[model samples]
Target chain A: MDTFVQQLINGLTIGSIYALIALGYTMVYGILRLINFAHGDIYMVGAYAGLFLATSLGFAANPSAFGFVVTLVGSMAIAAAMGMAIERFAYRPVRKFSKMTTLITAIGMSLLIEYLFVFFFEGKPRSFPQLLPNDNITLFGNATISTSQILIFVVSMVLMVILQYIIYKTKIGKAMRAVSFNLNSAKLMGINTDFVIAFTFALGSALAAAGGVLTAQYNPKIDPLMGIITGLKAFVAAVLGGIGNIPGAVLGGLLIGAAETMVVGYGSYIGIPSTYRDAVAFAILILVLLLRPAGLLGSNVQEKV
Target chain B: MNWVKSIIVGIIAIAILYVLNAAMSATGFFGIGIDDYQSRLLVFIAINVILATSLNLINGFTGQFSIGHAGFMAVGAYASAYFTVTHGKAIETSLSGLGETVASSIVLLLAIGIGALVAAIAGLIVGIPSLRLKGDYLAIVTLGFAEIIRIVILNIDAVGGATGYQVPGYANFLWIGIFAIITVVVIHNIVKSDAGRALISIREDELAAEAMGVNVTRYKVTSFVIGSAFAGVSGVLFAHYNKFLSTNDFQFIKSFEIIIMIVIGGMGSMTGAILGAIIVTLLPEILRLLPAIQIGETTFQFADLRLVIFALILILTMILRPQGILGTTEFTDFFKRFRRADKPTGGLE
Candidate 1:
């Protein structure tokens, strides 16, 4: 039972990170109807950005909560700019073409970002500096929660709440929702569709960057190639939750996180190795796709003939 | 008479190519044989041509976006390698008096056939259910299936798991050239067939094609099967060329490289795919020719930056010319145009 609780905690912690990234995926898919394959790389770029800022801004020297907060926001700000730039330069012109074209361009952009990072920083894995001092908080017998895990949850929740406020309460958020419903209708209704789309990219990328920083805080080790699998898993989470649905993304993210943790934790009893964790996500993706193409939360629409 | 003439022409072509291959290998200046790097390069180019053209059938002509070419390649590679590694000696031993070249080439062709068959089965598994999902969903599912195959290979130790397997009876340029020709001929014929017209229609518009009584799902699966079968052939060739097998070689990145070839070459054009295959295979080698430069006493190696340049090219090409180098025009388009000029009603086509 204690082990179960412990695994639950571990799962939710990872799930929260997946949720943050999935939100970005879901939001972009919501607005653009694109997979935005580069979104994961944005998460990676965010972590590196945090690493850079933490080191250069003297946050590494201080290692305080304030330092952590500053690094997170700074990374978010930088990633949001990147997201906008990508939309404007890489995606905007190709908007008139086929979805497959946009998708290939997204893939190309993903490769470009990953390899460019490898070029600039090389492929060396770096140890992220700890901004907040971490310690294990004992909850009960054999059920201890680490401070880093708590930080990840807290930070992600705060960002999510802030995200909710911006989306539900702000004009741009309504505009975004409108644009997602129908682009031309939104334009005819006098909503600035382009701005709304750009804003969606910014918001999604910022969330991903936050997820990146939080993941670094928990794991400490970071690499350029790290985003591919994680981002892909997040994509799986988005699809599982009924893509384009906000709450569904979070639910799917948590479910995947929990399921993956369980598989790793208890799979040994059934002849499943822990190394097969990556495979587990894809298997789930295939199963989910086969069973429910619209996802758990998405409503099934009739295929237009 | 026409059939007889074509068959004779085909036989003569094969003989001429066989003699040329033999000469090139013997001289090493005409510079063939498996021992030399250039010969190896030619073999790899041929292999890519097979992979790209076959992949183009599904992704380009059929218009289904699949990125799991490497998965089928893996199934082909492992099956053929397993067959050859285990039974190659048996065939060679049984045919001890058949001469080394004859027995080995026969064994190699058998392995390729078995590999392609196995890969076709794999394609069937990944395709039939997946074709239900339209467009991008199918793409993602195929990607997932590919990753799953890789992971499964990683666990099962019979095929060497993560460590890899050793393969003997390496295939040569002559066999690869022959098989490459077969793949091109098969794909080109498929594209010109009546069924090929259905595939093009599906790509043009799925709903409209379905409305026209086209069996959308069946044709999608057909192209996938045929495409994967060729990928299998490429895999057997790849396995023999390296004389080794590892699951690492068939990761999703390889699928992307194949896609990039088709993307660069021209998606639907057979000539484009072949040209794309040639350019993609040679691009890195060409870049490797640049000398390491010393800028302010710091050595700059262009080799490390090749993938970065590739990524840049991918992005810039998508932005500037997403249709690719040849667009939809085949090299044969020129001849077709001349023939049309010589006539009138055929010009409508």
Candidate 2:
């Protein structure tokens, strides 16, 4: 029972990271309908920026929790700017083009960003120094949780609440909602559609950056290629929870995380080794796509035909 | 006058390439037997040309974004490798207590056929569901399917799994060249056919094409199957030439490389596919020389930054020319004056 609870906690912690990343995917898809393949790389950039800020500035040796927050915020800010730049330079020119062209361009941009990171930071995985307590505290008989996991869960929940409020109550949120419904109509209504789209990218990218920082803290070791899998998995999460729906992304992320852990934990008995855990997400994606093209929470907006 | 000039130019270009191949081989440049390597590189370029051009049939001409080309390649590679190893002349002779040298003459075309068949089957499975989706959704699903196929292949121990499989090398420059010529000819014929026109119609507007009596789903599936089958054939060539196959070799990165070739060359044109394939394949080799230059206490090697620099180039190309280098134009189309001189006056411009 304790082991199960512990696993659940770990799953949720990981799921929280996925949820944050999935939010970016869902938001972009909701409005622009582009998958923004580079979103994952933006998260990677965020982690690296945090890593540079923490290590190069000597925050690693005697880091406080407050100092970690400062580094994270600054890194996310940089990532947000990067995301905006990508939108303007790589995506904007192809805005009026066919979705195929834009999709290919997005992929090219994803590759460019990944390779840029690879060039700057060698391909070797770098370790981030522990910024949280390593010691675990027992809750029940043996249901123990680490400080980092608790922090991740707490931060994730807090961010979700803040995001919920921003999306629901804010003026920009209203404009975003209007844009998601109809871009042409919203533009005629005096909404700055371009600014909203850029803000969406920046905001989504910033959330992903937070996820990246938290993931780095949890795993401690990261490389340029790390974002590819994380991005892919989050994409799956976005699809599973009914893309373009915020709450659905969270649910999808948790479900996927739990499913992945369970597969790794139990798949050994079925002759499928734990090493194939990476593939479970992809298989699930194919299955979901085949069975339910619209996804769990996605609405079917019919063609006028 | 134009025909004579065109033939002369073509002969000169081939002569130049041949001379360069010989000179590079004689000089031992780049330490990899440049002559042999260049010939081999040219063959690989042809194989890539075949794969990229075929993919363009679906992605560029038919207007579907299927990113599982490598999965089809894997299907073809393993299928061809299995057939050649199990039923080829060398294997049959060795099993009958005959020397490997005695069985060299009998060629096995079945390997290529089987490879393409298997790839087509895989394509059918992937395409059925994908026909319902479009754009990013389709891209994600195909990407997922490719990864799933790779992982499944890696876990299936019978096919050698993570350790990889090795087959007898049977491919040569002449055979590859012949296959390349066949690919170009076949695809060229297809592109000029009524079926090709239907595909172009779908690319322009799927709904309108459907209304105009074109079976949208059927055309899409046919394009996908044929494209994937060609990719499989390319894989078979690669497996035979390399004499080894691994699941890693058919990963998403390779699929991206092939896609880049199509995107850079001009998505819909066969000649553009070939042009793109050759340049994309050769650019990395060219970039290898860039690393020898030292920069401020740290030496940048092409091996380290090749992908990054290459990806940047891809981005720039897309930004500047999203339609690609040739933009659906054939090599002959560039020289309109010469072609116009021979054509009927006041024809379709």
Candidate 3:
């Protein structure tokens, strides 16, 4: 019982990170309908930026609560700018072309970013500086948890709430959503669809950066190539939750994270190695796509002839 | 008349390749059997042709973009490798494996057959779920699926785990050529068939194709499966030829590279696949000879510059000639004569 509860808590913590990154995927996909393969690399850039600020900027080996918050904000700012540039330069012009062409261009951008990082940063993994305390607080009789995990969940929820406020309460948010619903109509309404699209990418990318920082806190390691799988997994989560649905992305991320944890925990009982955890995620992805192509929370927009 | 010209053009191209292959083998340039390198080049070209062409079937012809060709190849590689490693020698021994008996031939056939069979099964499994999704969603799912296959294979201790599995080194130029020929022949035949027309119609417009008595979902699934089956067969050749195969070799990077071939070649053309594959493969080798120069004792080899140059080429190609070198036109189509009416000679002077 304790193990289940513990696993559940850890899964939720990680799932929040997935949810944060997945928000970016779902948002871009909503308006642009392009996967933004570079979104993952953007998250990676966020983590590295956070790492740079924390270490190079004379923050103590162990940071106070204020220091951690500042580093997180700075990293997210850089990531958001990077995301906006990627959309403006690589994606905006190609928007008029075929989806395949845009997709290929996105892939090129992805590879270009990933490889450039490798060349510049030297392809070795670096230990992330520890800012929070290492002590774990015992919750139940046998279940223990860490402050870092709590921080991840708390920060992600706060961000999501803030994002909700922006998306639902702001004029720009409504414009973004309107464009996603129908670009032709939005353009006719003088929405400046391009600016709205770029803004959406920036906002989503900033969220991913926050997720990257929080993840680094938990894992305490960051590498140039760190964003590849996590980015892909988050994309899967977005799709699983329904591509354009906001709440759905969060739900999908949490489900995948919890399911993955359960597979790791339970597979041990059945003598299956926990190393196959990644495979478990994809297997679930396939199942989701096969069972409900519209996604769990997504509505079908019928294909036009 | 068009078919006759296509057949004649095909024969002539094959004849040219055979002569070029023979000459390269005889030259023995760089002291390593030049012919062997050429044969290896041919093998790379052939495997790539199979990959790019099959992927084009889905991506270009059927308008369904799939990025999981490597997953199918992995399935085939492991299957064929398992066959040859487990059963090849044993069967060979039982059927006069120790002697110069013709029974060894039977074992050889079984290995290739078993390899292709296992790959086909994998194709069917992958294709079923593919029926539900469309475009980029399906591409991501397939990419994720391929990555999963790689990771799973890496973890499977029954195979070589991360180290990769080894198969008997029995595959050669002859066997590769034969299979390559068969793949091209079969695909070419299929492309000209009613099924090909149906596939093209889907590419033009999926909804329109569906409304016009074509079963859209069925055709998509069918072509996807068939394409995957060819990917499997190529994997078998790769496994047997390379001897040692690692899970990393079947990564998403490889699938992307194959996609580059399809994109750089004309998407739906067979000759484009062949040309794109050969050009992309040979580009690196050709780049190696680009005369390394030193900038103030900091020597930079052409090999080091290859990736940057290659990326530039890809970008330029995408921008300038998105239809690829041949576009939709086949090599045979170029040679077709166009009648030119005689110009009026200065008012009938």
What tens-digit string does per-residue lDDT give for candidate 2 at B47-87?
Answer: 89778888889888898888778889898888888888777
**What lDDT does each candidate get?**
0.89, 0.83, 0.81
lDDT per residue (tens digit) for residues A1-305 in model 3: 99999989888888899999999999999998899888988888999999899988766476788779888999999999999998887777678878887887777777667767775575788878877766799997899889899899899999999999999999999998899999989999999998999899899999999998899999987887788888888988998999999999999999989988988888888876888888777887888888887789998787654
Residue pairs with colliding backbones in model 1 are B28-B31
lDDT of 3 by residue, B243-288 (tens): 8899888877788888778778878888888777887788888978
Q: What ranking emerges by lDDT with the best candidate at the front?
A: 1, 2, 3
Model 1 / residue A27 / CA error / Å: 1.1
Clash list (residue pairs), candidate 3: B25-B35
Best of the candidates, lDDT: 1
The DockQ assigned to candidate 3 is: 0.48
Question: For residue A33, what is the lDDT in candidate 3?
Answer: 89
By DockQ, the best candidate is 1
lDDT of 1 by residue, B29-136 (tens): 455444467777888899999999999999999999999899999989999998988899999889879898888988998999999999999999999888888777
What candidate 2 gets wrong by more than 4 Å, as runs, is A1-3, B1-34, B86-108, B340-349
Write candidate 2's Cα lDDT for A69-145 as tens digits: 87889888999999999999988888887787788888888998888787888789999777655678889998888
Worst 10 residues of 2 chain B by lDDT: B99-108
Question: Which sequence of candidate numbers ranks them by DockQ, best first?
Answer: 1, 2, 3
| Per-residue lDDT of model 1, residues A1-305, tens digit only | 88999999999999999999999999988888889989999999999999999999999987898899999999999999999999999999899888888888888888889888987787999999999999999898889899999998898889888988988899988888888888999999999788888889999999999999999999998999899889999999999999999888989899999999999999999999988899888888888888998899998878665
